[model samples]
Target: MNVSQIKIENHNPYAVSFKTNLREYFMNAASVEGIPTVEYVSLEELKFLNSQSKDIRTGNITINPEDKEEVFKALNIVDRGEYFDNETIKDAIINPTAEGMRKLVGITDKFTFERVYAQFIGLKNNGEYDISNRVANVLERRFDEIQHRIFNTKITINEHGFKPKEDIEEIKQKNESLETTVQELQAQLAELKAMMVTASTPKKRKSKAELVVETENTTELDEVKE
Candidate 1:
């Protein structure tokens, strides 16, 4: 969305837009933001009333905990876990990007946060604090959910180690199948060992009757051969 390419509809062909980038944008009448958001930019204001006159904290519109709480009740959100990742709400206040907003607040989408941020900026520059009802409805949803959890305090939404029941069941079944296979293999090995032992046993030799060869010069085996 380039501002240069946009062509405005001229209800009256005689009206012309003046070009001036040197002056600061401001308004107290029908400003560029909020209820009577009639213009794309504000008109002009006193030198001290400029946004540059305010400090970093005071100048910013209410975007998060660090800024004012006019836009919404963002300060109610309390990050319980390591979801902050060592980041403070000030980071989100300074730069209300999707990720920063997600970390600060438990909201999933960035569009609503961005919309609220626009209001933050608009109000900062003396714009209106008009909030759309649609955005307002779900704005504090995360805060409410966090308050409902545990000890009724805000917390980070942790989505970790979530597995479907089917996957867990499959793993359990696989383990059972493996155990059964091992048991079968052990039984087969024991049977094979018993068979080998039976086959390898030597048959007992028949007891030879006492053959007493009374010959003085011949042995028992010589008598048998004769």
Candidate 2:
């Protein structure tokens, strides 16, 4: 009953012939009234269909309502008619990437970030003012992708030992240790210098005392001779 041994014929309805036992089992399982019709689909088509079904089950991309409101407020659409054309606005709404959204704003005599955002809102609200959630979804996904890339790049750099904070801290600790060692050495040198001074002072006093004793002895010898 190895299913892999079943011969799959490449024809309309894509016939699959199993062994006698399997065939008998299928026949018995089926109602005697009518045979079920078989449909054939290509592997590629099946994969495509599965992917589509998965996406539907997962649902389309969605951005938060608060985020949408923030984006709209940032755009500041004071006069909607000033910056947008019908077709360009529609295109921006369909594909709402930063660059794509910029096109909807059109060529302006004066342009600013806020102004560009405003134009984007203006375009979305142009006809029915009913903006698609898909646009927000696209924007949210794009921003998430960008943030993820930046986070990964930072991690990669850190793995290579190129982290700024860690390097700086290590260098700082080394400098502090060096400074402590230098201070200890200086303290040791001062102690040695003090010992040398103490030792030399006693030798100088002894030499002076011996000279006086020698002078007194010589005077006594002269007196005794006289």
Candidate 3:
């Protein structure tokens, strides 16, 4: 049978045999026609699949402990409200380079400088640095805010981004237009229905006087014929 003509029959609703029939049908169809298998997945399953795919795409990452410690220390220093005149420390942590580290920390020892630079590189690669992760977090927050605004206030993101103040006006205009169209259609439909009812209903019977006149005319004609 053609794919469109194929039907699933589930006669025993209470029995588990109905599922067996469905399975057999799909298997047989696939074997005979080389049809692709179809499977239903729950939302959780779909989410897991997406996460797996993302992980595969991201691949494996290895973090160096020494680098992690140094990066953590530097971040801690900044967290304690310490300020440095050199932008190199900030730039190095975000996008570390050997030259930048040397200028920022004044580390003339080759081995020490290399170690610190390696830590910065590791942090940058893992997206664990302040610049990247902080920015991502901020953007995520903003998106959540936008979502809340959209659903609660009927605001939509247009070319200019979120316009909470103008959203009400835009929605009102659209609602008014829709209401007007609905009213016009209702009036037109009412008129058409009235016309249909008038056309379908039988005309009222003639008055008794008119019927009597017609009957008398018929009788007179009949008498003349006789």
The top-ranked prediction according to lDDT is: 2
Using all chains and alpha carbons, the TM-scores for the candidates as numbered come to 0.25, 0.22, 0.24
TM-score of 2: 0.22
lDDT tens string, model 3, 95-142?
533343223344333332333344444445556555444323323343
Per-residue error for 178 in candidate 1, Å, reads 1.1
**Pairs clashing in candidate 1?**
26-43
Candidate with the larger TM-score of 1 and 2: 1
* Overall lDDT per candidate, in order of appearance: 0.37, 0.39, 0.38
Instruction: Return the TM-score for candidate 1, rounded to 2 decimals.
Output: 0.25
Arrange candidates by TM-score, highest first: which order? 1, 3, 2
- For model 3, what is the C-alpha lDDT against the true structure? 0.38
Candidate 2, pairs of clashing residues: 75-117, 75-118
Task: Tell me how candidate 1 scores on lDDT.
Answer: 0.37
Give lDDT tens digits, candidate 2, residues 1-226.
Answer: 1212321121111122222311211112112222332223233332333344321111111112233233224323233433332234445554344455433323222322223334345546555454556555433443344445422211111122222345657998999999999999999999999999888785434688889999999999999999
